[model samples]
Target: MVEKHTPSFIRKGSGKKKADTTEQFEKAVSRLAEGKYVLRLYVAGMTPNSARAIANLKKICEEHLAGRYDLNVIDVYRKPTLAKGEQIIAAPTLIKKLPLPMRKLIGDMSDEGKVLIGLDIRTR
Candidate 1:
């Protein structure tokens, strides 16, 4: 049996490789620029509540805001000062930083519809 040749991948410890091609990336970016949103999620620690929030946020991001959101999950436990600066009185709070007005949603973020509405993500 003849062996097939495969391209070798070098160990680039930088990070993940892009899943999309240039065209796809451009399309995603264009979609993002059109009514896209920037999100900052504050978590207190690695507790169950924090984990739930992260999972739910990811769910919303993937299902509704796929290519249209920039999610930043900041752990207050790691940086309590940041939390103080942001004046976060609650754990697992999602702050919509972009697309204006800056609305905040505090909870586990388990409700997809609520998350979508909060993030201004209109689905088809």
Candidate 2:
């Protein structure tokens, strides 16, 4: 199951609020301890390569990551600003942003082994 925590705001001049905030923060930290995966897939357009990459990525995430992952698919054709922000120099790029030691994999994601390894889904 996916873990979701609502941030508790601390009120001023209340010792109880401070303790509650600390407790909430610890709970949030504990929830993340299971290792949540944040992924971004950048595609140029609705080309064959882009479609394939999206399909492959979805399959991999369903099989390997399931509820533990958040996949954000960004189309450079539609939103060039997002592409520029990430400094993407190629189409069909996958960026793994969580679980520490961020990684980027470039391709249509045809090679499942390479994609899995690149995303730290599997040990090399």
Candidate 3:
């Protein structure tokens, strides 16, 4: 295993909002040096694609993030309101809501490289 340096994570109920401005966004990304990740996955029921996404994401998280991330799986079919709130147009979308500069990835998460890049796990 690579030597892991555990970063400090924002505690639950930290009430942090997504950064909007470029400066704020930069700050958010910089905070990743010392902050944990917060992730939310939106899916439509237990469809095949959704299931695959969940599984792929779990595997990636276990490998890269391990104890340093929060993963929330939301069934949009059951929570239309939440979907609407996030303006989610596609199913099986993963949203990284914390560690500054929120990010989103839309797919089944089958491509580990793409998912890792999208989630800022691997650069270049």
Candidate closest to the true structure, highest lDDT = 3
Tens-place lDDT per residue, model 1, 7-116, is 11111211234456887566545745686666777777677887788777777777766666666677666667767777789988888877766789999998778877
**Can you write out model 2's per-residue Cα lDDT over 1-124, one digit (the tens) per residue?**
3221111111111112335878856654664686777677777767888888877887788888888875667667766776777788899888876766778889999999999899877889
lDDT of 3 by residue, 54-107 (tens): 778888988998787767677776667777888899988888988656788999
Model 3 vs. true fold: TM: 0.72
TM-score of 1: 0.67
Off by over 4 Å in 1: 1-34, 122-124
TM-score of candidate 2 versus the correct structure, residues matched by position? 0.72
- TM-score per prediction, in order, is 0.67, 0.72, 0.72
Q: After aligning candidate 1 to the native by TM-score, how far in Å is the CA of 42 from where it should be?
A: 0.7
- Identify the superior model by TM-score, candidate 1 or candidate 2: 2
Off by over 4 Å in 3: 1-34
Please state every model's RMSD to the true fold in angstroms. Answer: 11.0, 10.2, 7.2
> How far off is model 1, as Cα RMSD?
11.0
- Model 2: ten consecutive residues of lowest lDDT: 5-14
